[model samples]
Target: MPAPTHLLIPYSFRRKGILLGALLGILLTACQPRHEQAAEAATPPVGHYEGSLNAAGQPEVRATLDIRHPSPGHYEAEFTAPGTLSFVADTIVFSNNQLRLIRPARPGQTLALTLEGDFWRGALTLDSTRATTILVKRGVPTPSTYRAEEVPQATGSAWLFTPADTGTPGAALALLPDAETAPTAAIWADALAREGLIVLLLPPTDSATAAAETPRLLAAVRLLRGTAGADTANVGVWATGARAAAVAQLLTTAEAPRVAFLMAHNMAVGPASNAVLRELRRRKLAVLGLYGGTTASQRATALRNALGGRRGGTVLTFRTAGPDLLRPDGGAFGPGLPGAVVEWLQGK
Candidate 1:
């Protein structure tokens, strides 16, 4: 056979090379923002610190905290950590080199804390939570010099929804709208229940946002669980996409409710996230994944191959290529198509 001119010519190869490079450049530029956003979300906005508290007097309350760098000499400040804090105005503030948290006071819960952070670590003793108490001591990195910049408000509709306990909820269903848009997946939730799984709709949010929102999300999950069947001992919890932080949380510690499945999309996790996932896998809980955004097709292939190799396994996915971000509030998140995640979970 005669050799093809394009194959024999060096210039042809160079043209292809240039085209490949151009495509790659465009792809990289397009992808950098999303990855950067993901990384950013993974970061807790620097100033607001978060930790759980067993005590909040008022059933409804908001919390906020502000930590700042003071005069570049010694870092000192004050802020309130309010419960049910608004995501719009109430932010985890850090400024003027001061530590301050301003949260709405709850009835019967006069608990508050005055925090101090320096180069080494921070000390947040309860100024009011329980007469006086000290919070967990964490090492703080070197403080940065103050730069006047407008702190952006937290965006998205992914609400915090933590359930009360490990029980079935009532008829009322808890729907978590994706930060980008509200998912109509509530319809699928009912279908999921038939398969011995209870779907916990979670909107997409990253670590920084999840830190404060996790509690509220958990609270809602707890609320919905109360509506489950009055006599089932097994309760399954489900979340998708970036909204998996609460599940990520429960896994980090031993406090997660009895779960049959932890359905997540893309399965993107970070250092803290990996810590949580490892813990869940340790507990023998199923970590199921559907079609997600990672282009390395081998990842899904590996997951399927790995599980398929087992004697018996549950799959939290479909033959689908990608997941969609269908928010209840009309906003969309990165990369996944929000199809029937609930159905996918219930093995439909």
Candidate 2:
């Protein structure tokens, strides 16, 4: 009777016992632990997220996560949208199944994240700039710390305080009393306060000689941005000079100095017009031009064609014409050309 068993079973020993049980089920799934087989192949979780427009046309946001572990790698998640981006909890870390997060900056940018656990599931990928960050991995789920807005400020009535570089902080100790100017730009603000560069002049919110010095020059442009990191603006055409050439001809029309001061060595301001230099290159600034006398090669050819387009904006000209050392002559430059455009903007 044993000889009758499947005609003596020799179909190559039943195809080597089903290929040795499929090579021991692919060597126990390649010996597990790739974030636990990507959290057991994203099982029984939840997910959904969405956003729109990017590829530089701007706006690309995301967030959709649904997970439930209740233990082990520990997780509980849900979201459809609620991420402006912020992180720190358990320093978030993952591998293979891939997930990562890191953000915390004590003075400027430091946002980060990595994605693909179904970016909010349907869609969510915001990145107006540096794109903030995001990610979710393995049993995938992420969304927490998405409420941190506070950037709606204006302090406007006029302020100007810029300088983090440009002729190296020579002018812009902030101004706005009709944006100061007169004779070579008011002796380039007294040779940029005798070359130490720190002036806070004021008087024109429509000066009746600024009754009691325009609230002490608008309290030094509103507390010099919590003191010395400067950079403030509340302008309508405040001076950088040819008397803010009609607010530098409406800063060549629109978006004037949201932050400006590029370079001015091949200098400018022959009374603002080429249609106010094309509305100051379509209202975008942060330009500076200086190249020795007579509007230096047309302020370095209209700041090299309005900062060479696609608007990443800025222009800082000076391959020469700003080192005559112990300068200030031509009746000491100022008292002549708007006090050398207010001592090259107070950095004299």
Candidate 3:
């Protein structure tokens, strides 16, 4: 006898259910790439990339790209080539494994690169020129660019940077914290050296007490005076972070003499007493005060007012520079900052 019609009906329903499941599987299979693409779009591949660019008839140019995501859906980037190119882009677009570096000016596209295996390879489109570029993610060392020699001091060792072209280069003692803790400070010293300034980068102590640290700083200053390529007559002090106040104190010390100028970066003037300002003014110190961020203008103005219009007291506000007196990426100085610093030094 044939099977009951009710059983056959149930079997037919089971077959339909299997076909429905197959259709759902196909739909999910088709949507998998879309889901993955959405995920990729949400999380951009932002990083620091260092590489070289090749143009049709020009020398190969070394470049560095820094992409940062400070907030949700907000991105900032910096592209730097020591002698070739430099720009900071606040607007950039990343999609489908492609990155577009948008210029704030007309003809928007600056660099159009695609994510390849361990590299961002593409063309740099600037004006009428296009260059083939390949970048590998790497941490470019800060002090690697300049030649440094260790000069042992009573307190510690100082890295001496002498200019190759100038026998008597303008000297500045960098009062920085530990290099491991503050790498940007080391970069600042290297940047000054790159501009042909003789820099004696002194090792910082654990203590920030002016009275305790001034002696060591003064000893390093004296050592800078005796250094072969350093110009003792034009020696100055470069201070950043908490060391700025101590540097001001150092200048007031009896042992500290022949200190022609003082360059303070990102220093809070609130910690400095009025007496210190008065003394600095009495000495006719050539002071360059640089403050950064939103309150830069106000801080700079306050410092200027504290100086009471002392000669050679030039205070500038770099809206884009970080607390370290360098661009956010720490790859280079802010707009014309290095040149302005060098010009001021030459005048002194």
- Please name the candidate that would achieve the greatest TM-score relative to the true structure: 3
How does each model score on TM-score?
0.36, 0.22, 0.57
Candidate with the larger lDDT of 2 and 3 = 3
Better of 1 and 3 by lDDT: 3
Residues 228-331, candidate 1: write the lDDT tens digits: 34222334444544554455565455443344555554444455565565555666766555543334255445444444434223344333333443222222
**lDDT for 132 (candidate 3):** 85
**In model 1, where do residues sit more than 4 Å from their true spots?**
1-177, 190-210, 228-232, 269-275, 292-296, 299-321, 325-348
Tell how far residue 71 is off in model 2, in angstroms: 28
Model 2, poorest ten-residue lDDT window?
A: 11-20
Error of 1 at 261 (Å): 2.5
- The TM-score between candidate 2 and the true structure equals 0.22
Candidate 2 overall Cα lDDT vs. reference? Answer: 0.31
Cα lDDT tens digits, model 3, 56-163, are: 887898988876544443344566676324544423566667776643222333788888866899988766768888998875322222334444444544555554
Number of the top-ranking candidate, with lDDT as the measure: 3
Residue 170's lDDT in candidate 2: 32
